[model samples]
Target chain A: MFQTISLFAPQLVLAFFASQLLSTGAFAKRDISIGVRNFSIFVLLIYSVIGFILGKPTGTAFKGALVIDDFSHYMNLIIGLSAAATLALSKSFFQIEKLDRFEFSILVLYCTLGMSIMVSANTLLALYIGIEMQSLALYIMAAFNRDSLRASEAGLKYFVLGALSSGLLLYGASLIYGFTGSIEFTQISEAISYGASPGIIAGMVFLLCGLAFKISAAPFHMWTPDVYEGAPTPVTAFFASVPKFAAMALIARLLVGPFETIVSQWQQVIVIFAILSMFIGAIGALVQVNIKRLMAYSSIANMGFALVALSAGNESGVKGMLIFMSIYVISIIGIFACILQMRIRDGMVENINDLAGLSKSNRSLALVLTVFMFSIMGIPPLLGFFGKFFAFVPAIEAGMVWLVVLALIASVIGAFYYLRLVKIIWGDESSHEFVEAPKTLRTIALMSSLLVFPILILPLISIPTQSLISRAASSLF
Target chain B: MLIAISFYSLAFVSVAAAFMVVASKNPVHSVLYLILTFFSAAGLFILMGAEFLALLIIMVYVGAVAVLFLFVVMMLDVDFVELKQGFLSYLPVGALVAIILLLEMLMVGAAYFAGETKTVVVRDNGVSNLEAFGQVLYTDYAGVFEAAGFVLLVAMIGAIVLTLRKREGVRKQIPSEQIARTKEKGLKMVDIKPGVGIE
Candidate 1:
């Protein structure tokens, strides 16, 4: 019994604690923050241990739906750590709003659990389950503040768009099943080696569409900006960071594992998608006034960068994509944590222009934000540059120099907006003054922004991070 | 041959009701039409020798999800008049997409029918669909299977969370005491005077 229970120890532990937290209404009345912060710490310390242990396990468990492996273990670690940051960020946001925290924290935990499952999933079905679990929790968080009209509208729009994507995904799965006669990735891989028909290709297209929606790739990214803008800042931060990491890993896992045989077929589709996504993400973000919306477009471009690596269909490319996304998610979380800490006369100051004269009022926050902006713009020494550098190198190695060049152009174009934000913060003092920062806000901003220090000092940690990337990517291929 | 009739009937019902679900004039009619579609789809699953899928369709989709839809359609004061807006505007594109889908399906069906006749070797391992399915669901194909369950679970939870709300105009019961009730103290059978009803 102990052994059986131990097989599912990670999931069981997460689920048990999540439920206990829910039933006891433990954090309902408190700062709503205390629970989330503690939960974040608990998850981080525990999962780091479990991730190492998880990678050491061999063979299949719970039938074959789960593969406890080195690759999954590394990804689980990255995803868990990202979610922990989200939790820490959430605590500060809740404390600021004085909103109910029980429901919010539980949703984040469950969502993290879902993403973790997706990274470890051995089947397409498991991946979808994980995606949906993360998505559903996110949808609620988008509209968690039901009182806000925009938030409610965001949730509704997200739901409708999300439902359409899910339909396409299921239809694609069904069509794939039609061709392979099996939904298992390995079986499908074997079946495809013999070759696939147009029906199968169509299914793959629809499958890509569903995933694109999740990651906010172009042509399927219409819902992203609105949803991100409407959602609370912390929720937007989580959206920008955690789920994308999990989703990208799964995307790499799926393509590198079973779909490698048909790279030529899918690569064409992915290239078109990637180029469009990069262009649209960069171009669309340029004009956006809302910081969250700009980030949404930025995310679309980021996913496009990841896709460029995916299109390479090689081990290094996959490894590069994972590492790139890890750093990208870190910087995004750090940036957004600062954004969440911003205060106005009302709840928040959401517009870009409102940030004018920030340096005069809060010099420390402004300086940290400049670091974040530099990283995002791919400026040297900051973490964001390495993310783009690694992501594009794989493309070049794969003989996708044309696409890499396009990505480079897009990144250059994308940098303007980040620089613009910096100008607002540091350039000139405007008439408007920043409202006082709460203790919670100060703590999150200080901690998350300090995260940039490591990225800036990447020379020190690049080797270990690089090795983890190789180890993580080794399992996928 | 008898199996063909059941298959044809289920297929016809599925297609026809699905059409009605889109074409119905009234929102209520659309909801009812969708329920019919679900039932027929379930019946089709049964004819395909997938007993579990057939039951799942009936229990989860037809029984619960469809009922939820019906309740929403029934309970909501939908301004059915506004639904007519842009109907004609959407017709051409919708029709084009539909026709393309139909053509694609027919082409696939033709190929499937043609292929089976060429390789008609029977290799049934005396295995239930459930057994092979379970194996695949757990192993190499496990990701897709779990994704299906997770998607459904998310949808289910989302439905409850999104819809079960307290609207400004609508009254809702508070569940505080409902949850706090002890099994020992909640059930009381006391007589009251006819003119004085218990408040």
Candidate 2:
């Protein structure tokens, strides 16, 4: 019982806040709302700190529905910190947009809770619930600006597609349950370890399709561009950064845990998704004018890179994947912080061309964006290079040279757009007058950008992360 | 043999009613057919020894949901003929999807019948099935039950958030503003105003 409660503490804390916000009208005041938001961030930060400190590996609880381990703890810290930063960054955006409702904070808290649940889930049932919880909050958040037609369209589109994916996931879950005679991951793993069944393969394919949709991988990535383009900017940032970790953690756990035995069956699917996503993300971003859509493609490609690590199917692969995910999310949040600061005549600007001559208008912000762009392009000595290196090295060591080579080519193609953005920022002639970004956004961008250098200098943090990742990887077997 | 006859007829009626729900030309007739479908489905559930499920179907689907559907269908002034105009054009695509679903279901049934998989045997634990279900739901699946509640809560919140709007000129009492009104602001002294009207 204690174990279960501890594992569920983040969600419980969020729920407590949500209930308070709903029941008491006092929290509707702006000051009270800000106070509640800060309290929430503090609570989540404390919870994540406690998770890190008590990183004692608890195998399974609640009859194997929840797993608490180093992987989940690591994820908790990453997700919690990202959420805290997102909330802090939201303040200026909300104030400017005149959307100062307390419900926004409550919804964000719920989204964080959902992500935490997904990271810790061990059963298909728990995993589905977590995914839905997160998706629902996201759908609401996307449509939060109901007065805007674009936001409503984005919300409806996301809701429809998200519902379809949830259906696919449910169908797959039922199929697995039918075949394995149990919904528990351990039982399913045990059942399928001996030999693969066609039914099981089909179920696994469906499940991967659903997971692919969540991660915005190819063939299932139809909704990403539109949703990202249309959703409110801060919500879009949250969508990009927070859910990726949880969903990827889920995929890693599911693939490395229950589905590990039938690697041959699922590995092909993962490879296909990875290659398709890489090429599609690379090719699709080239002609995009919208910065958000471009970032959408960039994220898809990055997920493909991380998926390459997962497809390697080894301890080193899991370690690489974790490092890649953390660094990738950090970079995304930083870049988006810069994007959120883009304004022309007090209205938000999203067109890539609008970034012309950013260096002249605001050199510091431009410099921060440049660092992020280079990191994303996988330049040497940057954190993103190591992220890609770890992701690729494991795959190559596992003898997936073809996949790695193709991924490298795709990265080269993807770099074109990132470089184009950089050129637009620094090289092009000035067009619109740029405004100084909020202090909070600037701080977040600077901190994330600056932290990337530590990975280069220390190189020692990887050692502990590697060991913990391996321990988490071994727990599945 | 009698039980089998009753079960088969119930199943047949349910299936036919379900088809009629879509095939009926009139919207009201369609709703009536839907109610029939639900009734037959509940009867079939009872025949299958799932008494609790049958009661739930009647209570939730027929009692509340179907009635709600009836109200909406009756209240809406939709042109049924115009609505049905596109039915023929949509039929082919819908049929294709239905066929695919049917084939998938058949495949699952075939797999189950092929003896390659084990059928789960739910042992009778000497308690009523309903009692057993409740016990298991409350114990082993309690966490999931709570999560379900959260899902419903989010749905409620989403609905309210999406549809809620403040109307123009709607006087909403702001307690803070009301409470902040001091005696000086709310009242003024009237000293001999009536007697000094000449001035």
Candidate 3:
């Protein structure tokens, strides 16, 4: 019982706070909303610090239904901090838009709780439950503004497709359980390490399909653009960052833990997904008008890059994937923050053309947006460049030079859209000017911009953080 | 032999009723067929000796789900024929999906039989079926059980938030106002001479 508590303390803490906030109807008043937001963020921050300190304890709970280790702890810290930042940035926006419902924060809390569970799950059953819990919250979050028809449509579409993929995932899990007589990752690893059967291979493929859909890789990325475009901008930012990290963490743990021995079979599959996602992301964004939809494609392409690192099937691969995911998430959050502040006269602007003459109006915000675009494009001496470099290095070392070359071409192609947005922001004249962003969003944007710049801060924290990430990565094997 | 015969009969009835559920023109009839299908499925579960699951199906699906479905079907003023107007036009596409699903199911079935497999469930020595189910669910899968509860809670909250509407003109009693009432505030004392021409 003590072991279970230790393993799940973060989720339990968030759950308790979430219920409290919900029961009190915190958002009905201004000060209560702020209080609930600050309290939850503080609690999450402290829990993440404790989780980080716990490190890789090699503790098992409930007969390996849950595991506490370096990888899970590291991901918990990343997810918790991102969630906290997201909530902080959303508070002012909610007040402005009259969307200050207490359910919004409570739902986000539950989603984060679900993500922490997902990262720690050791059994497929637990994993499925975690995923469902997270997706259910997300489905509601996507349609939190139920007054809008588009938001309702987005929610229904996401729920339907998400439920379908979950069904596929559960079916795959049942198949594996039937074949191996175990749902625990360690036991499955033991069984597969000896020899794999065709049934097991199919099961793994189905499972990968499910994870692929969750991460919005190509061929399963149908819902992303619509959902991103239709949901409230803050919810879109939350969707683009926290849940993606959790899903990527799950992919890493499953691939490196149980499916490691059968890399030869799944490697080709990952490579295929990587290649397709890259091409689709590049080609799909060229004609996009909405900035959010464009970012959706860029995210798909970036996930492909991370998958390339995972396909390397080594400790370095895992390390590189973590670095890549972290940078990409930060960049996405910053970009979405800027997008959220694109209000002109009264309504928010979502079209790329509406960004015309942004530099003339708000040069600082324009500069920050430029930095984010450059980082996403992986230009030299920027944070996103390092992310791609770290990921590609491991893949190259694994003799995936061909895949790396193709990914580079895709990066160049994908840069066109980002550059196009930059041109409109800086080079063109606009009829309307951007509204002043809330102080919290401005701070987040500044923080992300500083993190991505890489000149002053890179030397300060890179080596230590890199080594820590590597240590976490090595714990998987 | 008796168990096998009963199981086969139940399975056939369930499959036929399931087919009728989709084939019926009237939405209300479709719901009735769905209830029939659930009953037959529960019978099949009983034949398999999963008495707990059998009862659960009847209670949850037949008792709650089908009744709710019936209510919605009856309450809605939908034009059933109008809803089915596009069915013929979409038949070819639906057929294609059905064919693909059938082929995939066949593949999974083939794979299962081709491999050396063990039955997933083993009969325990001394425990009843309900007790065994309880032990496994509450012990081994306890985390999943709690997560299930979390999912349901989310669903409930979402349903309530989505369908709840605040109207423009409605009188609502403020609980705090009622609770905070004092005699001093509620009552007023008047100092006046009774029926005198003092004024």
Candidate 4:
């Protein structure tokens, strides 16, 4: 019992502090919203540090319900940092939108706790519970601005769809349990190693469908655009970055751990998801006017690329997925930080055209946005190119050359919108005079852009990231 | 023979009630049918020798959930006629989905029974069902049990955060302020003239 608790101490402590913060917010006489937000940020950073210090302790807790491995630790670190960065970026946006409730910070904390649990889940039950916990917090955060009808609609849509997906996931889990006679990943793998029944395959497909919805992969991505468009910008930023990594990590664990032997059965499903997501995400974003909606599609496409790596079903595949998502998360945070700074005297502008003449008005901000755009477009010498390169190489080696070629085509098509964004920011005439962004948001955006920019040095940042990710990925096998 | 008869009867009632739940036009009637369905399902569970699950179904679903549904259906003034307006247009797609689902379920059932898959059943340990459930839930599944608690906590917080709005010009009771009132503040002794109504 002690060992189990110790293994999960960071998440336990984070949840306790989150509850404490909730009560403090409820009881405090004066408005201490900023203090609470800052405290949550501090706690998140500390949680990440503690997880790093407790690096890769190989063990299982609660009788193999949760796994403590390098993959989980690395993913948790990324989740924690991105969540903190999200909270930090949210401060100014929350104040501007009159959404300075302290519950927001506490909810983000709990959401992070849930994601940490998700990446470490070793049982179907844990996966379902963790996803629910994360999603419940997210639904509330989506409608944090209760005064807006769109926000309420977004929350309702997300809740209804999320409930359906959870139902499908539970049904799949029950089917797997009935067929395999166990919920433990190891036992299930053992069961599959003998032979996979048709029932198990159906369950796997249903489970993947549900998991794909979480990552906003195509055919299950109906809710992403509306939710992204309607959710508050900071909340959308959090939605875009941290949860994607957690879900992807969970999927990778599921694939590499229990479903490794049944690769032939699931590989085609993943391939279809990848091809559909790439085409749909790339095409869907072309006509989108709202920057948030475009990002929604962009994320779908990015997950497609990650899926291509995952379809390889090997250590390199997981490595590439992690590295690609880490870089993607950073770039997304930078983009959202720039988006949050798009405030004018009237209100915040969300249209792509609204970025017109930003280069002349806010030269540095435009430059940061440009770097992020190019990075996401996977331009050579940028960090995103290396991410794509690593992700695609494993698939090519795995005899997925045709898929890579198609993905490249999709990405080429995807680049047009990104370039359009750049053109609007730098080329078009200044239409609206924007107010200055907060120093913290600007600094975060600048730092993220700098991280995405590959410094021409002997040891590039990707080298260290690759090494760490390879270690994490190898732990799964 | 008696157990089989009772099981069939209970199953029949439950299935009928479940169908009525979706087919009934009145929402209140639908909720009542839902409770009936729960009761019959509980009966079926009892027939299967799972008394603990049966009682749980009655206590949790029929007792609390059914009552809540009754209250909501009664209190909310939703227009059922307007809601059913699109039923005709949506019938084809709904029926197609229902048929596909039925076929898939049949296929799964066929596959399960025909294949070499064998369900591993736990041998009887001479303990009550509730005790056995508790043993695993608190011991083996403790992590998941605690995590489910967190899920509920998030749901509670979400409900309160989304709906609990503070409105101005509303009088509220402050127990601490009331308790802290001094005798002088609460019970001021006043001397009044005979005909002076405290103007």
Candidate 5:
């Protein structure tokens, strides 16, 4: 019992502090939104450090429901850092919009807790609960600005679609349970190793479909663009980065864990999802005027690339997925931070045209935005190139050369919109006079750009990250 | 034989009440039918020897949920006729959904019968249903149970965060102010001996 409790201490600490923040917000006489937001950031950073320190001891706790290992630790670190960054980014936006509710920070904390549980889940029950917890916070956050009809519609649409996906997941779980007589991933894998059953295959398909929706892969991505466009810029940033990484990590765990034996059955489905997402994400972004909607498509394409690596179904696959997602999260956060700074005299801008001549107005901001765009475009000498390189090599090694080629083509097509944004920022004439961004947001954007740009050149940062990712990936197998 | 008869009767009642729940025009009547359906479902659970589930169905669903539904249906001044105006136009899509559901169920049934899926056997443990349930829930599923608690907490917070607004000019009670009221603040020692004189 002591062992289990100690192994689960990080999550417990997060939940404890979150509840404390909730009560503090509730009882405080004066508005303490800034304090709460800063405190949440502090707590998240502390949690990340603690998770890293506790990364050495890898074991299952609570009768194998929760697995504490390098993989989970890596995911926790990503979730924690990105969550804190998101909170810091939201501070100025909230104040400007008069949404100074301390509950926002507390909800982000709880949402981070949910993602933590998701990455560590070893049982289907834990997985479902974790997903629900995360999604509930997200639904509320999506509609945090309740006065806007678009925000309310986004929330309702997300909730309805999310409920449907949960139902499908539950049905799949029940089917798998019925066929295999267990809900534990280890036991399920054992059962499958004996012999795969038709019911199990169907259940796996259903489960994959549900998970694909959570990751916003194609065919299940109908809700992404609207939700992204309608949500507040900061909330959309949070939506884009942390939850995507968590869901992708969860998918990796599920595929490499219980479904490892039945790879043949699931690989095809993942491939189709990958192909569709790449093409659709690439093609869909061509006509979108809203920058957020374009990002929504970009994320779909990014996940498609991650899925390509995941289709490899080996140690390198997980490693590549983690690396790709980490880089993706960093660049996306930087991009959104830049987006958050797109406010002019009237209000926050969302159109691609709003970025016209940003280079002329705010030189440094434009430079940072250009770097992020190029990085996401997978231009050489940037971090995103390595992310995509690592992702593609594994799939090619797994005899998925055709899929890799297709992905490369899709990425080439996807680069057009990114370059367009750069061109608008640097070449086009100035349209709107942009306001200066908050110090914290500017710092975050610059820092992320630095990470995406010079970190590749600096061996110190790249080597440690590579070693950590490899250890994390090898632990899963 | 007795068990079978009781099962069939409970099932019949439950299905009929469920059908009435959707078919009934009056929202209040629909809520009442929903309660009846819950009751019969609880009865079916009892027949299946899951008394704990039966009690839960009665206590949670019939007792709390159904009552809430009744209150909402009674309190809301919604026009049911206007709401149903699009029913005819939506019938084709609804029917398509119904057909798809029916086919899926049929497919599942066929797969179950044909596939090599083994039925899970319930072992006859000497403990009561509630005790067994508690043991499994608290021991094996303790982590998941705790996580579920967090999910519920998120729901609660989400509800309040989304809907609870402190509007201006709305009179509300301040408990501290009420409690801190002293004799000097609450009571005026002025004696109005005569109403005309006081005026």
Candidate 6:
């Protein structure tokens, strides 16, 4: 049990602290700061150190179903770090809104815990369990604010669509299990590649649909904007960033490892999704007024970029994805942090016009947001530029010139909206009143702002980062 | 042999009930049909030697999800008054789907029957089937399985997110405000006296 306990130690600690605080009635209905955010961050840091200590694939829990590896360990750190950022930013948002205290942080931590397990899965059963755990925690997070009708609506819409996707995935898994007479990922993968059973192909298609939804790729991304718009800003930010990383990892791991040998079919499927996601993400964001919805579209477009990297089906592509996602996640955190800090009067302050004269009010916050927008636009000298570069460089290297070209157009289109946000923030005065963000909110903005500068600090790190990405990619094979 | 028949039967019942579930006009019938489908599927699973999965499906899907449907149907005041029979327009599409399914099944069956294949003898749990699955699961193809699981996990979370959500502008309390008041312990009893009373 101690062995099993070790695999779970990180999450256990989160749960333990959350329970102790919540049960003590300390933060239960009181002023925010249940210390949940701080606790989650500490737990994540601990998990990272422990995971680093464990190094290669090691299992201490769940009878080998829940195992830790370099891939999962690294991702756990990312998820933890991102969750921490989300926590740091959330306090001010809640403070401004005058909403219920920090239970949302606990919810966010729980979801992160689920995602951590998910990335560590070995068997089909473990994989499913991890995913559900992550999703269930997230679902609550999405609708954490009970009073907001839109939030509840977002949760419901996500639930219905998500349920359908899960059913499809389950059906597909069953088919794979049935055909191969096994549910182990490796065995079934071999059965698909060498055997090429019709069941396997069908199963793969079904499974991909579920993956598509998670990544919010097009043709299957209908629910993204609605949910993004409906949920609270920080929760939406979490959706826009962290989950996609895990989803991309999942895609890279599953498709490349198992379906690479049968790339023709899977590649065609991915190509369609990639093309659609890019076009939709770019074109859709063009007219959107809501910042949250705009970010959602941005995420959709980003997923397109990630998928384009994925389409190449190699180690380079995977590395590109990691770099792309890392940078993208930071930029998104910044952008949403700015959005979270906005103190709107009409509950409609999310509109682009509402941001007019922001430059006059909070010049510093305005400037940080500008950097985030540029980064998202893939402008050079910003973190967003490198994310796009790393993701695309591999595609060109893979002889995917056309994809690179289309992606460029999409980037330009993406830039259009991102700059619109820039203009709205720094543009001429439309309103006299300037929204002020609390101290905690400022930190998130600063961190998000700093993400743009990290690229300048070390152009050399990209090489090693790409190397790690490549190694992680090959590890799947 | 027994296992195969039971598996096929369960699958058949589930499929049939699934069709019926959609076809039935009454929500009650639909709910019942779905439950039967789940149970049969569970039975089919049992035949395949996945005791855990078989039991799990029955317990979770049949026992929980389908039962949930039953409760929802029972509770909701649905207006079946305006419902009319629409068999005429739906027939062609239904028949088309059925034919396609039949063709697909025939193709699969034809390949199996026409091709020379060795019979797979059902082994008795192989000393331990769980261990066997676990061994293969952890190695070689672990990545794909994990990815699929992540997909499911995301879906589950997405479902919860989609449903249990709220909107902007609704007033709520700050977590800090709630906790700070309690820690300060502001409710203190102070002693006050008048000069006349003291005398």
In the range A277-390, model 4's lDDT, one tens digit per residue, is: 999999999999999999999999999999999999999999989989998999999999999999999889999999999999989999999999999999988888988998
Tens digits of per-residue lDDT for model 4, B1-199: 9998998899999989998998888899999999999999999888767899999999999999999999988998989889789788988999999899778878887889997646857547798889889889999998889889988988998889889987999999999998999988889677888998775
Query: Residue B190 in candidate 1 has what lDDT?
Result: 69
Instruction: Give the higher-TM-score candidate: 1 or 4.
Output: 4
* Model 2: per-residue Cα lDDT over A1-477, one tens digit each: 666666656566666766676656343543465666677678668756766554464666566667777777778778889988887878888888887666677777777777777888888988988888888989999998999999999999999999998888888888888888878888898988866566677788889889888998888999999999999998899988889878988998898888989887888999999999999999999999999999999988988999999889877888888889889988989988999889877689999999999999889888999999999899978888989998999999999999999999999999999999999999999898767778889899999899675554474876766676676666655
Clashing pairs in 2: none
* Candidate 6: residue B112 lDDT (0-100): 49
Q: List where candidate 4 sits over 4 angstroms from the true fold.
A: A1-5, A456-460, B23-25, B120-123, B173-199
Question: Can you write out model 1's per-residue Cα lDDT over B50-166, one digit (the tens) per residue?
Answer: 777888888988789888988888898877677888688999999999999899888876766766433223337887767867765667554455445544554555565556653
Judged by DockQ, which candidate is best?
Answer: 4
Residue B186 of model 5, lDDT score: 93
**Candidate 2, after superposition: displacement of residue A323 in Å?**
1.6
Worst 10 residues of 6 chain A by lDDT: A18-27
Docking class of 6: incorrect
Residue B75 lDDT in model 4? 99
| Residue-by-residue lDDT tens digits, candidate 6, A375-476 | 778877777787888888887987889988999988888888888878777766857564456777788778668867665448596566555556566666
Can you give the lDDT of residue A405 in candidate 1?
Answer: 91
> In candidate 6, residue B131 scores what lDDT?
68
TM-score against native, each model: 0.87, 0.88, 0.90, 0.94, 0.91, 0.81
Steric overlap count per candidate: 19, 0, 0, 0, 0, 39
Residue-wise C-alpha lDDT for candidate 3, range A184-233, written one tens digit per residue:
99999998887777667778888988988899999899999999998988
Q: For each candidate, report its DockQ versus the true two-chain complex.
A: 0.29, 0.37, 0.42, 0.73, 0.60, 0.09
* Ranking of candidates on TM-score, top first: 4, 5, 3, 2, 1, 6
Give the per-residue lDDT digits (tens) of candidate 5, residues B1-199. Answer: 9988998988999989998998787899999999999999999888767899999999999999999989999998979888688779988999999898678767766877886546675758788899988889988898889889989999999999888988899899999999999999898876678655654
